[model samples]
Target: MNIRKTVARVAGVGAVATAALGLFSTGAANADTFIPLPGGEITQTLSDGTVVTIKLVGESANISGSMGATPVHRNAWVSASAQVQISGDTSATGGKIFPGYVVGCQVTIDGGNVNGGASGGVSWDNSGNATPSASANSGANLTLGPGQAKSFYVLDQEVPDDYGNESHKTRNKFTGNSGSVTWSDETIGLNGCAGYAQARSFVSVEVETDNVISWVTLWGQPFSLG
Candidate 1:
């Protein structure tokens, strides 16, 4: 249950200036399409009576067509804020929050497949037990073919381990009733895919109690990558 916390702050005026530069910087080669997304929220109560709430706010993506100057490549920059709140008795000290995204190539992530299997390695089961695959990578630069998808964490925090060695983690651990993580202009580079693609955000929190441990996940609306 060891995790690191990283916070980034951006002033309103600075953000506006950055956007202006990105829009008027170049003609078509650097023409980035800014998309404002409607983030989502969810709440779940664990079996041990611990209530966990997750929210994704200020979601957005700026897509630039074919950074490789070829049809088989795509690139985008994403931003979002994931907030978590935990409430229960004394046993519910706190939890760990893991936030990431799933990118799919010609694959639908909004719903289940025809066979009710996981869509692009993500499960949105109705039993309030949604979870992402453990195969997610830490790097957003990825390669995929048709009918393929991959997941990656937004955080790559570097810290020291118990033995004073360098270590990396993708989650933020909190010991109170609330915690949050936010990222801005994170890169999502895709290669080897010539068709339409999509990306979705997820926040999974691991709640630890004296008697039981559980997880609750909240999924954001999926958006196109191309």
Candidate 2:
């Protein structure tokens, strides 16, 4: 149960004005919280040495908490934009996947597959339940081991745009291990706890598959940090 904490610079104001420049903490690139304000934005070079840009925007509406004297601090604006290149679980068994900040995602796999069938596939329930018989392709049953890797393009998967059951919003409650194809221009929403940025507030997730699951069961919102 590891939790990655997000820190605020609040830029001494003087440093930004005097030094003419300030840098955010260069830490793990896993699904982290990188909030830039007033004309601020975050750029990162991942473990693969690829550069990424993150945008943040404040809410237009002021939220009054409890309708009382204390006003809820405006949640800073944050948006992570990057090509979702995924891989690294083609071989490991009964493991987990994680958002290691900048290391991409560590996917988990198991020997489970379409119940009582040949060609052996991955399953979401290693407990010996059968997947929907209509499924066409198998889940992520591969890994890159401790060194190999792969990549994928990311775009938004909004429920409104979803033509099927694979939408991010629909999958949010599914307990089975799996991954999402984040569309370009998709809004991660706030708190990193749900919607698209769930991993943000999670710290880290633990992924495991022994009997039926093929993908992973995250451990922390940002596993490495968690």
Which number leads on TM-score?
1
Worst 10 residues of 2 by lDDT: 11-20
For each candidate, how many residue pairs have backbone atoms clashing (under 3 Å)?
0, 42
lDDT of 2 at 181: 16
Candidate 2: tens digits of C-alpha lDDT, residues 1-226: 2222121211000000000001111121223344322322333232332222222222111111111111111121222221111223322122221211111122221222212222212122433222212222211111122222221111112454345555331122213222221111122111111111111210011222222222221211221111
TM-score of each: 0.78, 0.21
> Model 1 segments beyond 4 Å from truth?
1-30, 112-136
Residue-level lDDT for 144 in candidate 2? 21
- The residue-level lDDT of candidate 1 at 222 comes to 72
Instruction: Go through the candidates in order and give each one's C-alpha lDDT.
Output: 0.60, 0.20
Determine which window of 10 residues in candidate 1 has minimal summed lDDT. 12-21
> What is the overall TM-score of model 2 with all chains considered together?
0.21
**Which ranges in model 2 have alpha carbons more than 4 Å from their true place?**
1-70, 82-199, 202-226
In model 1, pairs of residues that clash are none
Error of 2 at 166 (Å): 13
